[model samples]
Target: MPTATRVVCEQLAPTIADLAGNQRLVLETIARDVADGADIVVLPELATSGYVFESAEEARSVALRRDDPFFARVAELLTGTDAVAIFGFCEQSDGDELYNSAAVVTATGVVEVYRKVHLWDRETLVFTPGSAAPPVVDTAHGRVGVMVCYDLEFPEMPRSVALAGADLIAVPTNWPFTDVPAGERAPEVIHAQSSARANGVFIACCDRAGIERGQHWTEGTVIVDQFGWPIDRASGVARATADVFLHLARDKSISPHNDLLADRRPDVYPKGAAR
Candidate 1:
């Protein structure tokens, strides 16, 4: 029998550079969702520091060191809880470079920091690109893989994590409104769904809402099943928040005769090719 894990995606409209207020929101959300029986809670990219930087200088001003007291506060509060939080923020590394990063804070302490591998739009100018693969951590729910915003668009990111034995993928993003033609599923939603099915793992996407620095956001957050379908949400429309069970990700058998992961033909797959 597979164990079930409840996961929640929190969509927030965070004020840019308001680290104190944003930190409050994160802690509060974790408490609320934990009471609601969530085993895993995910927040939007740069949830504490916020997004939309005019320049590298502005981004650096809001970066948090790996040993900042912020994580200590989170660890202090999580001492007796089973919930784990994965959130995005600006990381001020020892090398003096700012990277768009996400951290996993458990009851014990901060376990992992995943730097964003794929930069988006103007982010390339303000943040250093991370060269490491996404980190997969063992949680009570299952092995959780972490990624940020633009990283999910590239199949390689999540696929690499799943291949590394992740039961679920958590993506914290600031999804801006892109021009999707009439009657089309938004690109972000499609990417989440497709990746979940392709990797045969559940996906929890936490996104930001409202405008940031004169730019509008799509605000379409969703939780996808391992088979690539959105879970039934009470909102009856696209919602910024939703919950799903982790055990669903444990099922990789497309049919009784074959398993999705076992069916891969990696031997013949090209290692690298020109796009």
Candidate 2:
């Protein structure tokens, strides 16, 4: 009775400084997910090159152009699959500066690029910040929005897109392991859950896992619904996939009760900030 959207979520252990190997893995994963009946496939952040690059020079060396041969190869694989592939890659721009960027690759072509807006510690030294927020785009599945690693931590990013009419938020992350007591409910995951519940939207957080350059990363990739509940979860570095029906459980009888966006008293809140 519920019309759910099917997506294949992939968790890959990307090898640092190995563009060719990464490309092969991405293509293989795409193929596997497509065969499994995925309407969409989301990969980890900086997927093409592992997240442990030592310097801007290091990141630049492995970064790929939008028109690179590898992207063309990916586009070729996307043909006839009818699945939109969203994945992260280090982008090389005009001045050759690098960006932590994600692209939504449809069967037709690349739809949009959502660059990392909020940079992490080492990332600030390497990549430039994106000034504008990414708007949600209408897709066959629904209205979807994209955000990179650190962007998911900020409420404004998701709030803005949700307010703009996004029904789903696709996040690509590479979270590091910490001693936080929440277990799988890390701050990043909490942020995703809260944002989803507050905005009345679904969230798909695809993260990188395993030891990268000797540092442990969090492997808690999940798909949460409007009630801020996870429908699917991954444990200890493996691939997990699921099909979610948007608006399945949500009915008109359930109105915006704890919704943060709807409850905001913008008149007073915005005035103080404007001053």
Candidate 3:
């Protein structure tokens, strides 16, 4: 039997520091993707707030509770839709701590809030590291997990999610100019592919584009298949769909090269050592 199909819309755009405008863009894009037959829509990191901010105060000004009026509006728009959405925003958790968080919202409400664990440079001074890893939540779409920008670069992050039985990993990132060797693929693009292929799970990576406050963002939004191959163009900023057989790949153990979870020998590998 053919597997269930899922479409992930990679919205590549720079979000200015406007709460209403950002929320509107997110809602409109989600609506379009759902209408276009997307089972899940992934928006760029910092979709709700501009990534390059002058100060933490500036970032905090736009931060909102998950149940804020803006997100409540998002919930209303998602009502009765089968698709789920993952987007980034500054989350105002209880106390004075602010977290760089991603929200996995379904028809009911916000299902999971994934605070970025690994901080990138100045991000450490602003947002605190998330104490716990985001749990892979079971949805009608599939076993889905969420990760922020820097988290996708580390193999341990996605490996944990895959070990928890996540069929799809939704990543939202604001990648800037880098000097890493991307080979045929750009660095950010190759990183996403590597992350997906390593975990033997589908990757939907949505990235922020355009020059924001002097930082050049590499807007290489891509959707990767089981073998770390791009099913669509690498540099295009459009919605693309890939038909993936998650159960077949998982149950049949059809991961390419068996690198991450597929061929790990945990019995001999020491804790904190590379496998």
Q: Model 3 scores what on Cα lDDT?
A: 0.77
What lDDT score belongs to each candidate, Candidate 1 first?
0.83, 0.80, 0.77
1-275 per-residue lDDT for model 2 (tens digits)? 64668866687889988888888898898887877788778899989988989988889988988777776676677788667788999989877678899988877777787788899988999898877687576777777889987898777788788878787888888888766864446778888888888788888889887788897887878888877888887876676676877554233124557444656677767754423
* Deviation from native of the Cα of residue 48 in model 3, angstroms: 0.5
Residue 41 accuracy (lDDT) in model 1: 84
Question: Which candidate ranks first by lDDT, i.e. highest?
Answer: 1
Best candidate, TM-score: 1
Q: What are the models' TM-scores?
A: 0.93, 0.91, 0.90
- lDDT per residue as tens, model 3, 1-275: 65576757465564567877887788888887777777788888888887887778888888888778776666677788877888999888787887889998887888888899988988887788998886697877678888888898887888888889888888888888666555555676787787777777888778776777788876667778877888754353565566666564365255365445657788877877633
Backbone clash tally for model 1? 0
lDDT at position 261, candidate 2: 61
Among all windows of ten consecutive residues in candidate 3, which has the lowest summed lDDT?
Answer: 249-258
Per-residue lDDT value at 179 in model 3: 64
Clashes within 3 Å, all models in order: 0, 1, 0
